[model samples]
Target: MEQELKAHLKKLMASGDVAGIIALKSERGMAKPYLFADASELECLCLTPKYPMASVARLLLDEDGAARFAIVCRGCDERALRELAKRHQVDLDRLVIVGIPCDEEMARECACPEPFPSVVAVGTKLEQWEAEDIGAAYRAMELDEKLAFWKHQLEKCNKCYGCRNACPMCFCKDCELENALWVKHGRLPPEFPIYHMIRAFHLAGKCIACGECQRACPSDIPLMVLNTLLREDMEELFGYVSGTGADAENPLYTKEEMQ
Candidate 1:
């Protein structure tokens, strides 16, 4: 698979279809995200347990690195990129997707459905699991239980902003989380559930369930549950599914766009 991906990327770069390609590269012992313009760097590229690729995609697309760029995306990353593209932050036509199917471990880790891109350049497709029941289970909890659950969950927060920083969709230069008005400056451990609640509300309909936030947290917060619940609600209320179609828009942002 790695050989196939490298060959495909080499072909794309050689053909002058894309100025560069954004993919995961290994630096030191840890896997980090980077943009590969020279084909020689493809030797450093890898698909691994780490999902630093999505973060790279976000950075590359947001920065507008090239008019045409290719991303080596798995299921979650593919959905995230599509969602970003739909929000008008990423140009779908400017991006070329090279789908990489997730292994069993990756699929189980994210509970991902459609563990490959809707469009594929390489790799086999995997079925995506429905997270409806997971969302319902969270919603079914008692109010006190929910409160306690979140409290205990957020207590592990080191206020690292790993979740926000890792999220492909959180591209705001003036973030509400940092502003004194909403998040209050000079506070450690944040404001408990409020910090998370603010994040959840901000991501309400925009989160693409990539699980990067959960994965990035050193404390391993189950942030995906909150994201999944809100996503379920957004789907139910607006008949919206993030990244399902090229032009489909999230109603929350669409309302704001109209205003």
Candidate 2:
């Protein structure tokens, strides 16, 4: 699929359709995201474990040097951009999507049914994954159990802020997490579930389940599960999926839109 995608990208570039292609490359110990400009750079375009290429797409768009760009996307990333486009944060018409399908193993790892992008280069399309009640298990646990679980988990936090920083949909100019009132300054471990819950609540309707938050967590908390579960509730109760349509408004802030 990488070769096929490379060929497609090469064709697009040959036609001067895009200025650059943002994809992943296997380097050092892990797969890292990179932008490939010349055709020769496609050899480095590897597809693998790392994902949520939407943030990289946003980064490329922010660069004044990048006029048009293409990104290899999974279902989650594609959905993220769909929502972002509605906010006028992205110009989808000027961007290209190279779809990559998810295999059974990958889908199981993510507990994802809709693993592949709706649009992509090559692969067998599978049935959309239903959003499961993963949180029921979490919710079933006793409050003390949940608190202890999070306490242990939060102890492992390095205070890197990578989870917040790596999110594509988290574009607040004034992030509440940083406010001294909400989260005290210079506090390590950050006062447990408050920090985590605050972030999760903020992402209630907007999180695209990209799993970047979990990947970014040096502590390896299953943060995506909580956020994704809340996202499901938002979808069910409000009829809003974060990255579905260009104009799909989140009901939380748009009380008028809800009416």
lDDT of 1 at 172: 84
Residue range 1-259, candidate 1, lDDT tens digits: 8889899899999998887887778788667677889999999887786574655766676676557888888777877777777666677687788888776676767776556777678776555454334566778899999999889888888889999998888988888888777676777777876788999999987887788899889988899999888887888888887757767877886755432
What TM-scores do the predictions have? 0.89, 0.88
For every candidate structure, what is the RMSD over all alpha carbons to the true structure, in angstroms? 2.8, 2.4
Off by over 4 Å in 2: 28-30, 127-132, 142-148, 257-259
Q: What is the C-alpha lDDT profile of model 2 across 73-183, one tens digit per residue?
A: 888889888877777777788688878887767776776636877775777666655645567788789989988887888777767889999888887789988898888
In model 2, residue pairs whose N, Cα or C atoms come closer than 3 Å (at least 3 residues apart or on different chains), thus clashing, are: 99-120, 113-129, 114-129
lDDT assessment of candidate 2: 0.79
